[model samples]
Target: MVIGLWLASLLLALLTLLPLWRFEAWWVRGLDFPRLQLAVLAVVIVVLQLLFTDLTQFNQWSMLLISSGCLLFQLWWILPYTPLFSKEVMATAADSTSPCIAILNSNVLGPNRNAQALIDLVKQHQPDILVTLESNSWWQQQLDQLSDSYPHSVKCPLDNLYGMHVYSRLPLHNASLQFLVEEGVPSIHAEAELTDGSRIAVHFLHPAPPSPSENYSSEERDAELLVVASSVKDVTTPVIVAGDLNDVAWSETTRLFRKISGLLDPRIGRGMFNSFHADYPFMRWPLDHIFHSSHFTLQQLQRLPSIGSDHFPMLVRLCYTGRQQPQDGVDPDQDDKQLAQDKMMAQAVAPDQVHRPETQAVP
Candidate 1:
């Protein structure tokens, strides 16, 4: 029985390191979760190792291997908590009062027919801007009533998963939808003129997830996000980028995106606002996010009610101050972080790249 326990402990320790392999298999991706589970298993292995010290006859070399594996797994488990991986930024003071702009991001399931629930949610919040993803022609028409309330609009209704629509009460100057990653995947880029006369740049995206039917790998998705991050790096205007990133806030890629873009995540010091898998709350991660440049301050962030969609909308209100200045104690060299993001995006957007699909604009 002692031999069996030792072998079992060794197997568990080895299993914890499997996620380190960069593979496209579902089993590999599924292991993205359960880091905590692996941590617990590592602890159990250590306890077993200590208890079995008396059973030296059971292959000393095998026991040494198991102990070393457990130690490595323990180190991997705590890596995320390290400061080098993720940094927290505090909200800064702003001169403008009442500069709040409320934004709602919702993914209306393409096939779901209940549009009234979504309309009701919008009515209840009355946000300054509403961005809907996975919207088709039918979904666009269903939301036509909103045009009267929000005079400015940008709509791209494609059958592809990247279909997107943006409606805003604020004037959207030079607003255009661009496919930064894939041909049909649209991202809205515009200068929003706030009620207080301050201009803010906003970018909205809904990149396709890495999956067999969508794409074989996360290269395209990751690269596209890097492109967006790089574009907003040195802007003088207050900037806000929000969407369903399809990545958790804790992921290494997301952290790199934040550092590269020089954007502030509301989730810092705040809890993870997991927005996906509303049906299975336990399995949810912070997929929907609102990231802002340091020029703005977070006024409010909340999860909206479900409207017959797989994703619950995220509502964030940010107050724009004046442009950040180095003399004012704000770091001027912050834009340097965009270099890595720019390099990644440039490589991903190269003409010969096969991961990104051909983009098609919707009429």
Candidate 2:
């Protein structure tokens, strides 16, 4: 029994430490998804080692110390998302006089048949903007019903799972699809004019995930996100970067993205609001996200009901007011900028990817 427990401790310790090394290997980076689960197990082991085992033993001492440290680190990273910590983005009343922009970001699995569920969500929430990832031609046809409600739009209905579509009630200017890091993968960039005549830049992305079947490493995903971060760093306009980031809120890449781009995650004080793995409640993490600028205060950040996809839709209602006080932002240091630049340069671009996808105005 002691040997078996020791083996488990060693395995857990290794898994907990793997993501800290900045390894791009899919298996290593994949460890970032289960910090909560691992922390729970680590604490249990620590308790067992302390109460039931002989801590004087060298192996027992090592196990207890390692497990306790892992638990502390994991909790430190996730504590911000819990209600116990202060909110990173300030919240305001949803019905305030300031112009509110509610955005619903959904990754409607390309073949999922429950289109009405998503449609119902959109109708019920009536978000000013709707961004859908993994949408194909068939999904586009199904989502056409939304056009009557969201007249202004952009669509890239590729058969590839990377397909994306954006529908907005507000007028969108210079909306274009950009293939940032990988061929055939596209991200959307646009300026949305809010009701108060103020414009905020919105960048929607769904980069490929690192997996055995997908991209072998997270290089392309990290590069695409960082490249966007680099582009948005200097913009004076209010910005909203929202979509299925295919990354967790606490991942190093995401933290780096926030630091470099100077974006704020509404979920910091809100909740984990896990949006992916809708089918498996036990194996889930937040993959869908909406990171915005300090120009807007969060009115509501909620996880909408699942729409028969692996990912549940996220509703972020933000109030845009020029008077909203600037919140604390992460200033990227030289090392962060250098790391981002290196990742961007590492992603190999194809010949046709040199130009942005032609701007297609949705009628």
Candidate 3:
């Protein structure tokens, strides 16, 4: 019994410390996703140790201390998203003439043939802008009915699973498709002209994840996000960055991206809004995201019903005041900036240079 307790405590401690290392390996970086799960594990282990183990000994006491610390750390990272903490994004009244825009971001699993369900959601919500990832030519044909409602669009349909399409009710100017870090993975950048003649910059991305089948490391994904973040760091226009980042909201890379870009996540202090893995209720995380500049105030944010895809659609409605500043998030320190630079440089190789392995239908 004592041996098992010690081993369990040691394992929990190691898991807590693994994400602290700056490595981009799938295992190391992937540790960032389950902070809440880790917290629960730590609490349960601490309880078991206290109830069953003899803590009179020095080593036993030390183990308890380490486990307690792990619990605290995990909670610190997670509780901010719960109701216990104040909201990060300010809420205000929304009106049609005041630059209010509703956006829906969905990662329609490439092979999932349930188009009617997604189409039904689109018709029901009637979002002003829709961003779909993993959308190929077939998905395009299924979603073509949206063009009648959303006149402005940027489409890049590819079979490689990184295809993307953005449809907007507002006018899109200077709409360009970019292959930031990887060629097959495309991103959208454009200026959206609102009904009142106001404009905001919109950047849509669906970066690859750090999995054995995808880029072995997070170098390409982190680089793609940071590269886009860096480009808009000094832009004066209101900005919105949306889509499946494939990274968790609390991950160090995502936090750094927010700081460098001076953007805000509506999920903070609101809810996890876990969008991916719609099939599994237990194993899920917030892979899709919507980050906007402070000039906008949130009116509504919701995780829509499953569209028969692996990911749940995320809908956000925000009103641009053009005066208010967004809530500040974690600011990237000097070391964080250096880390981003290193990751970006690591992806400097040609996209084709990275071996593309056959992947399952999950993003």
Candidate 4:
């Protein structure tokens, strides 16, 4: 029993620490999703080890300390998203506010037939804009009920599972599809005209994820995001980049994205609104994201209930202050800029690395 406990502790500790290396392989990047889970499991292993093992021995004490150390490392990253840390997006000091835009971001899981669930939420929330991912032609057809309500829309229906649809009650100008890395994969970009006649530049994406059955490395996903991040820097108007980012909120890639784009996440200092794996509570992380520039303040951020997809939808309302507020997100260094440049430069997106949505090992 002592030997068994020590082995489990050692293996668990190694798994927890594997993500420290900046490797893009799917397994390593996948490890990035389960940090909270890993931290919880580490606690369990530590408890069992203390109860069953002889701590005076060299090997036993060493394994216990190593596992405890790993648990702390995971917590360091996870704590920022909790109330224990400072909030990234705070309420504005001014009582008089600019126009507010409510956005609902959902990955409708192409094959999932329960369209009414999402539609019902859309009707209830009445968001200013709605972004749907994994939305194929059928999903798009099912969602046609929204056209009368959302006259301004952009539709990119694809069977590849990277399809995206944007329905907005607000007027959208220069709304076009952009192929950042992969040809079939598309991202939506537009300038949303608010009721106050101010425009907030919006970028919506559903990038291909890193998975054993999909892209083996996160290079393409990372590169595609960096391409968008690089563009956000050029826009003078208040910008918002929101969608199913396919990366966790705490990963190095997402951190780099936040830094490069100068966008703040409302989730920080609030909670990890783990949006993915809605069916399985044990294996869930924040895949759906809504990020905006510092000029906006968060009014509401909520993780809506499941819509029969692997991911639950995210609803966020932001009050655009019409002028620049303090920037609370991470700042981009020269190295960060150079790294984003390199990722975009190397985006000769490998053909084999890209896979269809139907091929994903969806549970």
lDDT of each: 0.70, 0.85, 0.84, 0.85
What lDDT does model 1 reach? 0.70
Ranking of all candidate structures by their TM-score, best first: 2, 3, 4, 1
What local lDDT does model 3 show for residue 167?
A: 86
Error of 2 at 280 (Å): 1.1
State the local distance difference test value for candidate 3: 0.84
Q: For candidate 4, what is the TM-score? A: 0.92
Better of 1 and 3 by lDDT: 3
The lowest-lDDT stretch of 10 consecutive residues in candidate 1 is: 354-363
lDDT of 3 by residue, 1-363 (tens): 778878988999999999989888888989999887889899999999999878788988988998999999888888877778788888866443467889999999999899888888889988889899999999999898888898888899999888899988898877778787887998888778777887778889999999888978888899988877776666666888999999988888998999888788888878888897899887788899999888888889999999889999999999988675647666778988777777777877333222111111212
The residue pairs found clashing in candidate 2 are none
Which 10 residues in a row give candidate 2 its minimum summed lDDT?
350-359
For model 2 the TM-score comes to 0.93
Q: lDDT score, residue 211, model 1?
A: 64
Can you give the lDDT of residue 64 in candidate 3?
90
**lDDT value for candidate 2?**
0.85
Best by TM-score: 2
Worst 10 residues of 3 by lDDT: 354-363
* TM-score of each predicted structure versus truth: 0.76, 0.93, 0.93, 0.92
Instruction: Kindly indicate the candidate among 1 and 3 with the higher TM-score.
Output: 3
